[model samples]
Target: MKSESIVVVGAGVIGLDVALVLAKRGYGRNTTIIAEHLPGDTSINYTSPWAGANFSAISASDANALRWDKLGYAYLLSLAAKDDKDAFVKESTSTEYWDEMPSPAKIDSMAKYLKNFKEIPAGDLPSGVAYGIEFTTITLNAPMHIRYLLRKLTEEYGVRVVRKRVSDITSGFLSKDTKVVFNCTGNASRDLNGVQDSKCYPTRGQILLAKAPHIQQNVMRHGKDYETYVIPRPYSNGNVILGGFMQKGVSTADTFSYETESILSRTTAMLPSLASSETQILAAFSGLRPSREGGARVSKEVIQVDGTGRQGVLVHNYGAGGTGFQAGYGMAIEAANTVAEELQALA
Candidate 1:
């Protein structure tokens, strides 16, 4: 019998992470990745690189997303502590609020997992901010992390990555031996031929990167009007990410609006030291987060092509919205487990 081959669509963080998990689990050696976009390319269709790429616990009361977030947080922290520390950093993050009250149960739930959980004294918080929560979380330099994952997949696991656009799955590319297909196309899923899921939509988020001097650690402020967060990148890069605005159904990628500027100005005003500093504005970028109506959609199904009686397994792992990096590992694990189970049954 010939070995099975699987083709994973999309090369963003989600795709690469799933590929890594599949490879690690002793999958087919002929696995290949067909993607129109890859890391380091600042394309609007790809949202992995534009993330503030930190582990912030903001999922709703859904059980699956909550499980994925918790699992991903532990995986990222382990990576940061073990070998990827230079690329990923674990630090104490302070989430402060102004006139917004997060549930104590939610805060305590997050604290149980993070290290150094605490509430700030009234005097220590910024004016008009009544509460704060400090806890440990991981941050990743998204470009570097994605590149690292790709490198590992290629160099270590021998997975093949090809740069191509896949319009239809049943065309000439798929084979009888191809038992499963994993879709991680992020925002492009709405247009991708075989998987035109109408529920998939883009939530546009814009961010500003500036070289801040001597500021370390992550800070976030939440309010009814706006939410702002600043995360320090790895390697003392001096570049911190200031963001962001979440506009739903807006797909324009060009960073031309003054609205993003206003967002940055408001964020800096919340952290005055960042505004008054001499930090040079490096760049402003926008990414459309792949968000579904309910939450992230991960499931397994068998799809029958037009003429081919052969059915191929389709495992969807997209609709992460803005929390891709934080939920990448766990979701990949779950998706891979589903694929493995399907493959085992077929065998």
Candidate 2:
């Protein structure tokens, strides 16, 4: 029998990662990634590009999230070790000074999963830091990582990436040959004609990217009012990602009036050494995270329209919220398994 073709919407990290996994499983020759935006083209519509994208699960108690995050962390660290080291790298990260520390239940699970987990020494703790923990985590340079995935998919798996805005799936663009449609459209899923999931909303996040002098690790501080983090980028871009503010339902793409200056001021205050660095302000950007009514919706379902038994299967993999890159591989694996099952049913 001929292979079943799959149309994966969105070329962001999740979409691309799903396509790659599907291809690796011998489904690549039959997969296509259709999207309105691609990597390297930073737009408000695409959230994958503008991400601090580290792997620290705030949802340790949530079984599904815990599984996804653990799988994702393992996958990312493996990729960092074998592939281009510069593409993704793991470094020591410190989370310090929380008004309230994480619940004991979650901390116990975290300790079991992380290989390099440890407590910060009392002497090294920041002024307000009452307690802190350090762990090994990976950070990704979105543009470079996405490009690398695309290149690998095209070169090794023969996966096709189509640059087009898909308003509806039932249109002529998809046909009987397309047995499975993985909806990884991120924020655009809300506007998709056939799949208008009203529960899908955007969470606005803004960040400042600046060149800092020789900072090679990650630092995060929690306060009564706000949380601050500084993450190093690839190849000593001399620039670190300083962010962020999570303003739910704020969809405007442009940088807000106060947010632009505020992020820089706040970040510099946290790391005093950044004050005298002769670094340049690269850019300030924002993206809307695609959040769903209930956390991430990674289920398979069938939609009927106009009494026609279209019989197309949708493996919904959107709603990573702000942690798309962190949970991407794990979610994609789940999505790929769903696609395989759907294809088997079709056969």
Candidate 3:
């Protein structure tokens, strides 16, 4: 049942996970990861390395979306439990605040898998918050974990990597042997040739890294107007990220002083320990979250391979926005299954 080789474009978290899943599912030796950016490369266009990378999701209403959330949550929990340093996931705590109390249905549904889930008492709540939930969660050393994936894909799983820019599917298709192409290009799909999906857009997020060793837990406040969070990079020494705003369609990388101060004011207020004199600012930056107007697209299509007469299957697993890290594996599993089904039909 072995088919022709496959090509995977993009090396971000979503793409890497997709490659890893494909490798694990018996497509190991024939897959190649081609991308403009790889792990350890920093660019405003690259979002995975800059993630808060926590294992929490906003209240997802769609059952399929919720299933992805739970699947990813469980996968991450397993990694956190493992003692491997390269995996870089560790058990942590999450306390999420809401400006108004969520529906009873919402709480009940989320609590089903939120280990150590509890409603924080009103007396302990900070001002300007109406409802809060605390649960056991996990944080990732994102960069380290991504590099680990790349290493495992190449060395352990026999997958190959070609770190190059794919100008477009027609001109940049990596191989003639490729029977299926997975477009995990993230937000780059808006301009990718042969598939410029207008639904793709960028949600710019700003962050400030701080030396806050005393702060070990994640805290977030969600409101109709805004959202703010403090996430500790677990294995990184004394580092935590304070962020942010999802300014849709904004691509500028400017980190304004006022915006920086605003992030500092809001995040430190949530955790007074962060404002201590011992804490020092390390860096400030921004990245564009790859977003689609109607959530992520994990569907399949039969299109001309490299604009040639020969047709091939193309599976898309991009446009995850901020939810990419949390629901990535779930999406990858589905994408891999789609690849399998398409190959079976071709057979």
Candidate 4:
């Protein structure tokens, strides 16, 4: 193994972070990132840009998931510490209301990892809430975060980025001798050649962006299969994200008026002023979350390069669903470690 040539098949936050970490580990120059779309471009296929990118341990009950969140929290905290310019991420208070009580083990995990985690007093809990918790978490400007990641990979780390559609994961291969390949193609894996993951499915998320600078904190309400959240953008003339649904197997580009109205109606109850004319509601759009059954696939797999006799280390890092931003760093670190270990073993 030369520890020189590598390929990552997407440019979303997950792929970018994986490339960045590998670059830092001395795979800088020869590493190539191939993607159909790059940062600053708008498309329904690109989900990270449309995210209300924030940190929440709502998905961190499993030990592996919690570990990823923990690593991400520490890394995100470092960004918040030096965010005098509000470049990457911002720290904010997050209050979550659940219609059904989460298991005590889940609450304990949040308490152990989340900053200033606490159970909301019964009097403090809002109506229709069976459980509540308050904690400090970090929110990100999704667009800025991805662009910054791209700059770091190209400028700071000398990683190469290619803009082209790949028919399959193997299309990103630069050379037959390539020691490692990362599959970060999100939901594309379902139809993606050489990786038709039948379990990979799409979950559509709808959100409304409004100018609500007065709202500085994050609020989330979960009931049965539906969820509504209010996430104020870090520093964007008071733009807040109001959302959403996890409609499985739905990937239509259409945005319905009733869906927007429903979001506004439910969210306005939490922040009455959001209904006022003073708060201008901007765009209403939807994107597909690349969800997989049985959670994200974050492991090492060995495989032959199709027709080629040579084999390479393939690190699976996609299927994060909506938790990509919250758990990206940890997953990147874990994937990069595997690349390093395998490269050494092959060498």
Can you write out model 3's per-residue Cα lDDT over 1-347, one digit (the tens) per residue? 22237778899999999988888876878788888999999888888998887876453446656777788888888877874467888888999998877667667767898789998999888888899999988788878889889998888888888888877754334556667888999989999987799999998988998888988999999877677999988888879989988888999977888889999998988888887998989988888899888788898888776435877778889988887778888899988888786555443
- What order do you get sorting by lDDT, best first? 3, 4, 1, 2
RMSD of each: 2.4, 2.5, 2.2, 1.9
Number of colliding residue pairs in each model: 0, 1, 0, 0
* lDDT: worst 10-residue window of model 1: 85-94
Q: How many angstroms is residue 311 displaced in model 4 relative to the true structure, after the best TM-score fit?
A: 1.1
Two-way lDDT contest, 1 vs 2, winner: 1
lDDT, residue 250, model 2:
84
lDDT of 2: 0.75
Clashing pairs in 4: none
How accurate locally, in lDDT, is each candidate?
0.76, 0.75, 0.83, 0.82
lDDT of 2 by residue, 1-347 (tens): 22337888889999998988887777777787888888778888888888875666443346667777777888887887777454655544545345466667656766787758887787877677666788887877776788778888888898887888866755413666777888898887787887788888998878878887566677776665565778777654567888777677889888875886777787777777777747577888887888876778788887752256666677889888867887888899998887677656544
Worst 10 residues of 2 by lDDT: 90-99
Q: How much is the lDDT of residue 254 in candidate 3?
A: 79
Residue 44's C-alpha lDDT in candidate 1? Answer: 85
Model 4: per-residue lDDT, tens digit, 80-193?
A: 888524456888999999989877876877788788898899888888899999999898988888888898889988888889898866665667757788988888878888
Name the best candidate (by TM-score): 4
